[model samples]
Target chain A: MAETAVAVHAPGAGEIARKRPYIPVFVILAVVTGIELAITQPGLPEIEHSLRIIVLVILSTIKASLVIAYYMHLRYEPRWLALIPLAGLALVAVLVTALTATVAHP
Target chain B: MAHPDSVDEGGEEHHGSPWPVVIAVGMGIGYVGIVSASIPILVVGAAVFAAGAGGWVHVDMERPSRAFYGLAAAIESRFPRVSARKLALWLFLVTEIMFFSAIIGASWTLRLRTTTPGAAFQAPWARPGEILNVLLTGANTFILICSSVTMVEALAAIERGDQRKVRYFLLATLLLGITFLSIQAFEYQKLYFGDGLTFTQVPAHASEVNKLYGPTFYAQTGVHGSHVTAGVLALAYVTRKAFKGGFTKDNHEAVELVGLYWHFVDVVWIFLFTIVYLI
Candidate 1:
């Protein structure tokens, strides 16, 4: 009699056909980077310094999120795994707040 | 075909390896050497670290990489089943997140303090493109983003058991990583020697800039450049292993793990380009 074996199944051709949109993500990343470069051009119309900073930060954050989600496969992982990075971000928040507070009041 | 190396219901047996402990000991000694500023001790520590790393790689290269799920079958059912190695890698990445945050945060603080009005060191910060070559670095940034794409595609290819595509994609990623580093090295040389952007001094043309500008810029970007170098080395290893047929459709966790690190580095550059270059 053959013994029953438990194994992780590799994805089949059908599953492979349903690949994640890595190319689309790459295109988005490249486009956003281009936008970032365009807005920060030396000869461009002068945006407010603070406003330019805000726009750049938002754009970069979007790019970073896309890479993390699709390229790093975080979006496909179990939900709990995200909590690990979220915990790290929480510490970063505290650190940033403290640093800003110190600079403000010093 | 079912995976030949799958764990049985009783749980897989794990062999202990001493290389990791050796690596840790070597790093600890290296840290002590740095703290004490002793060249001889540092050299010794580095030698030991290299030996440990070589041993680990040699050992690992001999066999196809295996995924180890640490918990027993019954307990594993109670929790989401993640490979033990992958869990450890995620935990390591979290520490990396904190590490980079501290470095960038300190640089920002220095920038804020020195550039503020009525502060002792009241020189203004350099506007965008005043000193550094934004166009060149922007192109380098694109190269890094391309590498990230190839990295993911490599993992995707291996998951489908397409060995040829895996080799090609991994080679592309490794080349792209090398290109990114080469561009960075060229930029660093040009900035430091041609443009006078040393750690202690700014370019003569930028006399009104804060003295801290050079230090902060180098501190933030230098550490990031070092990380890219490390990532390139890791990419080379994985590329070679892929060519050697060390990984399979089911045993390509190393590819995925390295891709995670590579993408993380690209993510860091996304923000770094904004913070250090654009802003």
Candidate 2:
């Protein structure tokens, strides 16, 4: 039940697990999310449609990169590891573009 | 003892949790019930699912199962390539991206085509903050963001061998996940019962808007909610293992992977908020 404690200082592994300041990133996320909400109010439907889509997509990408880099330890792992998931993403992009095009026309 | 420091491919044993199977059975039955329109079967399925989930949690709380310590990790070096799991997850995410793109793209297409007057089945998109409780959902979004931070911090703590912080951050993340879901449940309750949104029907007063709103709302949010639920279950298992002294600075891959999943879920929500509520 206390695997976290074990992982923390397990005899000789503490060198890897250390603390860092994450508050700033959290703050950025909060501010961006707030902006997303603010710009999406009713009176600005015309403005909300395109602008909201762009900002939200950007914000989510940023958030995903942070998690992948820090939490998933992709930064520390062999660089080759990154390519594995990237390949998957590339395929997904193709699928999406194809499907979206079909939906739009059909 | 096997050289404790020497990393083996399969360093630990994974006694897979039975709860997942139980939950699956419950869902299967519930699905059948829905199709059959059998109230008792549905209720029974739900009860079994709940019981299985409760038992699984109880088991996890008891202790982390022994690690499988599969030799796959050692064998991974033979390929001298990208770690298999990381590659697999990325591939999975890519598919997920497409899945979401389809949903969002379809919605956008509807918004554009229908907004034109006299178009077949013409109706306007819901204005921002018109149908949704924007402020409340925004707050929930904020909560999800915080959980993402906590999840990353937990991984960082594991990296530094700070067991206490790892536990603290993971626990914090678990709570934040619950809070976000609670807010969503509240939102759904208000929308379905209070605001008259249902799967196949819209409120009497909402005719000016496209009828697609109900299905879209449920599709996007329902999928996200299921992801949150999965994250919660993963956290619970990891937390139990943390309590059992399972992970070590060198062997905490489980925590990191789960954090990745949690973050991915958060990323999904960020887009979801934008598309469903904001746009």
Candidate 3:
């Protein structure tokens, strides 16, 4: 059925119709999520709670990047477009850091 | 059919859809229903919303409408490089980031302050898998991750002008999204009624587990679940559009944008599952 749809709407001139090389990215995401889950187990009794929190945050950032770059098509878009979301992340960093510090001491 | 951008295409057929207006009205009604807190009104609003959404998809599936608005021209205009739609999406995402951060930050602050020993007033944070169903939600996390894969593939299929693959992948994503929501509903029932974790009320026989559990549980998962619901609705709309053949190789910005939002939602859930369930 999908083949029929593709056949019917043949690619227009100058339009890029290449297959996205995405399977490897999915594999990486799965591996990262698995690692994230494994690190949370109680078996790592020696690790401090704060370090665990840091690890989880870092893992989440990596996963978010994968989705933004590939699924969001940021890599295919113009380079300047990247700055828009980066601004959001910068704001988030300032907010989280400030809030975390204040809460920690207060 | 020749490209819509052809030089002599000024008189080409216009397939302008009316569903956008219908959607706006439905949303207006739904907001009114929410404010009124009337069950009947809410149901009516939801019906209107669903019908508008269904009609929109129905129109989208028919054919790809051509446009002379070249990407270069789009970028060169007032806002230029990024289209208005793309800009709006970015702004919306920024707000979403803040929204999730607020929830995650509040939960973290609560956990940190509560777990402090002999602090003025402190309640111990629940350890991993203590008062919640962590493994079940973990599995749900994986389910969401799989949906993201299908979603990305659907976008790819559209890009390749492979409508058949697009439809199949979209249908798969929709099914996965529905399954995720169903599991969430089941989880909510078990937690709220069976295990005594209500939004405001805790069970009478509750321990310290019942004290602060309500806030954190709802804050973390509630926000995430709402996002999942939104994604599910979007998935349904896009799937219906796919069935009607709404997208083509070069004119499917809507599908791509929706896919971006869905993937972002999946990423948010991944982190939520880690913080709320695993940690």
Give the candidate number with the greatest DockQ.
1
lDDT of 1 by residue, A1-106 (tens): 0111114424462275357898999899999999999998977899999999999999999999999888888888768778888998999999999999999998
lDDT of each residue in B174-279, candidate 3, tens digit only: 9999999899999988878887777665555455543566778788888888988988888887788777777777567677778878988987887787778766
Tell me the tens digit of each residue's lDDT in model 3 across A1-106.
Answer: 2233323334442254344557777888888888876776666655687898888878887887887887777886668778877888888898889888977788
True contacts kept of 1: 0.62
Better of 1 and 3 by TM-score: 1
Task: Estimate, for each residue in B109-223, the C-alpha lDDT of model 2 and write its tens digit.
Answer: 6666666666777777777677778899888988888888888887777766678988988899999999988989998998899988887667766757788788888888888
Clashes of each: 0, 37, 8
Task: Give per-residue CA lDDT, model 1, range B1-279, as digits (tens).
Answer: 223343344544335667878888888889889999999889888888888888877776656655666542235556566666777888898898988899999998989998888988688999989998888999999999999988988888888888998899999999999999899889989989998988889999997888888888888888888999989888888888888998887677788888888998998899989999999
Candidate 1: which pairs clash? none
Off by over 4 Å in 3: A1-19, A43-46, A101-106, B1-83, B118-120, B200-206
**What does the i-RMS of model 2 come to?**
5.8
Worst 10 residues of 3 chain B by lDDT: B65-74
Residue runs of model 2 more than 4 Å from their true location after superposition: A1-21, A42-52, B1-95, B109-113, B116-118, B201-206
Q: What share of the true interface contacts does each candidate keep?
A: 0.62, 0.47, 0.30
What is the DockQ for all candidates, taken in turn? 0.53, 0.36, 0.29
